[model samples]
Target: MGFILLALGLVLIAEGLVYALAPSLVEHLLEMLRALSEAQRRNAGLAALALGLILVWLAFRFGV
Candidate 1:
């Protein structure tokens, strides 16, 4: 439970920084995502998920 909260807080901090530092860039990114087809979006999401899982695995493996 604590780890979940930590991960959520870190994600929020990163997201907040992006919006705070470059609101326009975030809008542009969203627009590009909107332009993608549904299949493309799903693939992109899956890729991100895989990458995140790999990263988490690495962290655990290395005792980080």
Candidate 2:
């Protein structure tokens, strides 16, 4: 449990760094999605979900 918390903390820190350094990148991504049609927006959301799942799988596989 301690190790899991530590790993989660590190992930939060990394996410904070990226949020601080490139907030505009996040905004731009949202903007791009806003420009898409409804169906395309839904597809993009599904793609994001799949990507996140892949990342989680990789993290577990690599023991991180």
Best by TM-score: 1
In candidate 2, which residue ranges exceed 4 Å CA deviation? Answer: 1-30
Task: For residues 1-64, write the lDDT of model 1, one tens digit per residue.
Answer: 9879988999999999999999999999999999999999999999999999999899989996
Model 2 agreement with the true structure over 1-64: per-residue lDDT tens digits: 9867986898899989989999999899879878999999889889988997898799889996
What overall lDDT goes with each candidate model?
Answer: 0.96, 0.88
Clashes of 1: 0
Reference-based lDDT, residue 52, model 2: 73
For the record, the alpha-carbon RMSD of candidate 2 to the native fold, in angstroms, is 3.2
lDDT of 2: 0.88
